[model samples]
Target chain A: GAGVSQSPRYKVAKRGQDVALRCDPISGHVSLFWYQQALGQGPEFLTYFQNEAQLDKSGLPSDRFFAERPEGSVSTLKIQRTQQEDSAVYLCASSRPPGEKLFFGSGTQLSVL
Target chain B: EDKVVQSPLSLVVHEGDTVTLNCSYEVTNFRSLLWYKQEKKAPTFLFMLTSSGIEKKSGRLSSILDKKELSSILNITATQTGDSAIYLCAAKGYGGATNKLIFGTGTLLAVQP
Candidate 1:
């Protein structure tokens, strides 16, 4: 089966620009998650979705960060006014349910200049 | 707040050697622990350990979870150069609308031929 897939394998944006990263979860996956990983650090939770409803966004670093899963199988993590600190690898993962093994996407490397 | 910590930031080993990675977590309503091997991109799921299944093995990889200690260990026997990558550990936090994963800093493994 195809695993989770993320688009724009790499992205480069100027500071203050807006960027939206896309994630296509595995077919029929009910749960999706987003994470950010900075160099030399582990991936940090950004948000979560169960079906088409987002249930958690506490991990989002700031108000500029937003996410949505309108169709349940696809999600997008949008960063408004990208900053240098936001330059990290944005990873997407999906699972049949919470607490189960998650399949991950290659991730979008976001570089803010 | 939940947190995951991994010991030995990095390790270097030769093919045919054995290695073990550690993960300790502090989280409320712990659901399960997971191990992943990440090369240059996404993480590849290796194992998932819950109370019901605290031990799991696959090929040269095996993992055990100690709920009482809130820790887990991943052991690889007869390591090969292909096994070189970042080993990540994550703990699932329970009792939420969506399960959230807390990740450790990860252990960088370098296998030499």
Candidate 2:
């Protein structure tokens, strides 16, 4: 793909439900990042990956929020027991080695009811 | 904690007007500052400033960084309705092992014809 691609453009889940969002980064990109953007706010870092290595997960809000890039290409973010506060846009970005410029995907908007 | 702050949460301007957005940051081991323009879903990369006092320009958009002041500014000249969007600023920091970005709350620009 010419750019990062994300799945499930919009998701509406009841409170306590589990949801999964997927991201397919640009081919051969070495770095992948996930960010969460609330209404009227900028995107906040969630996690980062260098190839298949989970180099950073400190930004994950809680234990219930998990992300993985097992094969170093496609990634998934799963949220368990979603709360109303979890409603936001989840963005995925990828960058080549050196990671100076990031190409982002159209995010998945999650609304927890 | 690393932090990024953007001023003028919202601004309203008419076509052909000029506007400047401000961003300040406090971070450890700062690597660079980046500007992004966000529309309905995705944020597109604009400029990345590493050296102070040097400005980067693209068409009607331009930005500069000041390391001594730990701040950056984005300037848009002859603004158009198409330029109406949220402008975000992010500071990249190097922790021991991983490089991460801290973003500001963003400045909302509304351009009226």
Top TM-score model: 2
lDDT of each: 0.91, 0.94
Docking model 2 quality class: medium
Write down the RMSD of candidate 2 (Cα, Å). 0.9
CA lDDT for candidate 1 = 0.91
Quote model 2's TM-score.
0.98
Best by lDDT: 2
Per-candidate TM-scores read 0.95, 0.98
Off by over 4 Å in 1: B52-54
Docking class of 1: high
DockQ scores of the candidates: 0.83, 0.78
In the range A7-110, model 1's lDDT, one tens digit per residue, is: 99999999999999999998988989999999989999889999988888889999999999987778999999999999999999998854378889999999
lDDT, candidate 2, A1-113, per-residue tens: 89999999999999999999999999999899999999998898999999999898988999999999999999999999999999999999999988877889999999999
